[model samples]
Target: MQVFVFDWTAYSENVDKFRENGKMIRLGKKHFNAKTAVDTYKNHAEAWQELERYGFDGVAINEHHGTPFGLGNSPNLMAAALSQLTERIKILVYANLLPIHEPLRLAEEIAMLDCMTGGRFICGVGRGAPREYKIFNVPMSESRGRFNEAFEVMRRAWTEDSFSFDGEFYKFDDVSIWPRPVQEPYPPIWVPLTGSKESIEWAAAHDAAITPGVFPGPMREDTIRYFAECQARYGRKVDPNKISIMVDCYVADSKEQAVDEYGSHLMYLFNTLLRYDQVWQEDVKKKGYYSSTAFEHLRNGAKGTLAEDDTVFNEWSMDTVRAAAENMPLGTADEIVERIIAECDDAGANNVLLVCNRGDIPHDMYLNQIRRIGEEVLPRLQAHNVTFVPHAQFEQAAS
Candidate 1:
């Protein structure tokens, strides 16, 4: 399968030293230094170049606003920087949250990036985090509708010379984006498929690529299968290479080494960084912001957890960490290769997104881990019928 690195650019330099006692992660800015944030941008660019040198098909970035969990408040900014840095690897912005953006502006920005990268950009779209919607003063209830409408505008803007749109969320009269994307039929659109059936169906209907994110157990595999099912209904071919599976990954000399170094950092992130702002959650609940299916899935995922607990540090245990790492390729090089292949075989996943660093892991450790995976795991993966097909090729095939 084609391999990608999902860089969170997590600001993990001094979190333990600065966090307020009993407060959740990303809650405050006591530890967040402006200088460090600037330094992180440099680090991310350097790391991406190293990943490209080590042989990754692409590097994916995501947007997270008002949180130190990810500094990519605007992933397009990172994409712009990387476009100048790297020449070969694909730049997958696994979504620019549509609800938070002006679609026409986003369309031109992406088109500019596509041209800058010589057609190496793959656009990924999503509804965004509920917390971000609140932070941006957007009503979460309109997320899906806004996302659908924005995507249509973006697509037409990329393809048409001059187009007018009248939609519920956006209206444009005879507007055209300059410097259309280099890729024919515009750069391919990928969707980050969480637990949204509607999103999965929509992606398939539009012949967009699907990247299934980390969910509880069989749900990830089930989601990929569901994508195939949706494609069948739409009479579209299911492309394994475009079906990406994202997982939390760390590898070292031994399983113990990997666990001891990365395990607690990972646990800290899931426990602290991933904890939705309680106020935001409550507001969403009061407003019924989530779709019924999305809400049900969230409820199911939080069952018996300390989602409501005040003691944030005590929220997770080794049991939970190990359970979460079960499906992940988290051991040595050999172990990682084995698990990855088996997973791709089971889920029909031909693309993988590896989150190589999180929390307070050292930069050297992250680079070393990526080096080993590249030297050992990637060569083996290449033998397994995995190759990236260009977005333009897919467009040509359809035409």
Candidate 2:
């Protein structure tokens, strides 16, 4: 079984006494008054190194925003840092938001990282959240279209010596990019998901890896069912290694303590995170993302928040917030393993990615969970062969 580790590297200095003020917490090294990401990097450096030490085959990173909610919107830059810190473990940026920046430069940056990492890079891309689009002055509606084109352009820019393209969103003539990606044809493209039908279909057509957030909750089952249904309807068979499910995890001696301790962080995720769901703003439409199937306008980013509807957040609505938090298993190692395995089987998923330190899980809790997972749960999962293998490190045995 292949296993991957995911961390938002959530920042905060308090270390104890949970509180978020109904806003995104300033939880990272940089945002929580730490001098820089390098400082926050120190906190996780050992943990990530531990993931590698404990036999996780791949390590994944993601972007988030707002003080206490997220400070790292440039996960790719950090991915480069990880390449130096980790060895043998596959490195992935669960995504680099495509529409927010120039695709060509992004492509080159990824390519450069690939070469530097000796081809250990697993490139994930996406149209990203509407709030981000609003923040960057990019239209939400146009993001998907631009995303599709930008992906194509990146592929070309990475593989071909010279290429050009003309699309509604991006146009380039005489496009010659240097430092082609080390992985022949291109590195694996992990399609970060937002649980949209359109997004699923796109991943299927391209045979890209799919990674979606399954915030611990009652909705976990629904999240699994939806994705499995989409893949099946489209005749897409996701190789377990290529498909991943994300979990906001914190391990505790008992479930109640887990919930009580982690509740505040969960609240922040629910409230502040809701703000990002909206597909608000006239610019998003003007850019060709004019119509969106996304459950947009669930929060405040002020591009014209859409009235709440059932279609967007689905089972993850306001009422279910408590249930969702309740669903995240914060118990003994065995219990967590059982819950994770059951959830994976029910949802037809095999990969379990835990974003540690999220919700400000305590350092001791983090250490215990990591070791427990490594010492107990992981071997069992491997024995069952029920999950993706954390990319294994191989060396030539003496012949």
Candidate 3:
């Protein structure tokens, strides 16, 4: 099993000041303190360096724009810095928004990072969040078209000697990149799934790895099953090594102690930061950002309000957090190990991305959790191996 830490890189200072009427003021740049931002990045960089010392296999970062939710607006830049900062740990850009980027430029940037890291970079791409589309002034309806074309352009740029592409959103003539990727064809491509069937099919068609986004148990299982089915359609077998699960975790003396120490930070993430762009989801849905049946499998018999209303936001509370933690790996080290093993066993996923820092957790507290998990929980996870994928087996048996 491969264990990676997913750092949110949230801006923690004066969080309340950036909110108005219970909603985050997206234009609150006046409140931004230069020193605070600089120190935050410095602290996070130091923490990432410590991951190497703590025995973690890799560190994952992501991209977001014009929001305090994540400070990594340019994850590629951070990945470049990580290349020089650490020697052994893999750097995963848990993704770049494909639709908004110039495909060839991104291809070159990723290639450079791959070479800089000695082929340790994992190239993750996504259609991106609705807010990002708005940030880049891209029409939501054109997202899939742009993403498809951009990905092809990048793929061709990496593999072909000199290629010309004439697509709906991108065009090039006899272009060749200077530094090809160190990885044979290209660095591994991984997509973060948000229950979109289209995204799953696209990933499967490309034979790219996937990390089923954080969701409830049943939903996550359904996602894996659906992804397995899609893989089979492309005549590929499910590979557990390519399937990863993301989980928010905290470790302490007991479940109570863990909650006491980490509950507030977790709540701040859910109750505040996560909801900053909640309203945009509906607008994006109207503009065709999400498929009409995006989360259909997860809906079960309930009304399809998953896309219509942000129910997750309405239901978040400290009590809900504590109850959810029961099923999560947020307890003592022994309990965390047991729960994480069970989770991997249930999903048949071999890679786990643990998120210990969210909601602007204090730097010292974040480092402490990382050290604790690295010392007590990581070794056990690394030793345990998952041999089969249940979803793939079910799909094969049905076939």
Q: List the candidates' TM-scores in order.
A: 0.88, 0.76, 0.95
RMSD of each: 5.3, 8.4, 1.9
Q: What residue pairs clash in candidate 1, if any at all? A: none
What does the lDDT come to for candidate 3? 0.85
Task: Please give the lDDT score at residue 67 for candidate 2.
Answer: 40
The model with the greatest TM-score is: 3
- Per-residue lDDT of 83-153 in model 2, one digit per residue for the tens? 88877778888788888878999999998889878999989887765667766887565777888898889
Off by over 4 Å in 2: 14-32, 36-38, 65-67, 212-236, 271-326, 362-364, 387-399
Clashes (backbone N, CA, C under 3 Å), per candidate, total: 0, 24, 0
Q: Residue 240 error for model 1, in Å?
A: 0.5
**Better model by lDDT: candidate 2 vs candidate 3:** 3
The sequence of per-residue lDDT tens digits that candidate 1 reaches over residues 1-399 is: 688888888875645554467565554655568888877788778889998898789999999987667888889989999999999999999889999899999999999999999999999998886777778898877888898999999999988889999999999999988989999899988887766667777888899888764532445545555666667677665777777777667777877777777888887676666663534444555654555565233334433222223323346677766765666678788888888776666555688888878865667887887788789887787678744323323333544
Which portions of model 3 show Cα errors greater than 4 Å? 21-23, 293-311
What TM-score does model 2 achieve against the real structure? 0.76
The total number of steric clashes, by the backbone 3 Å criterion, in model 2 comes to 24
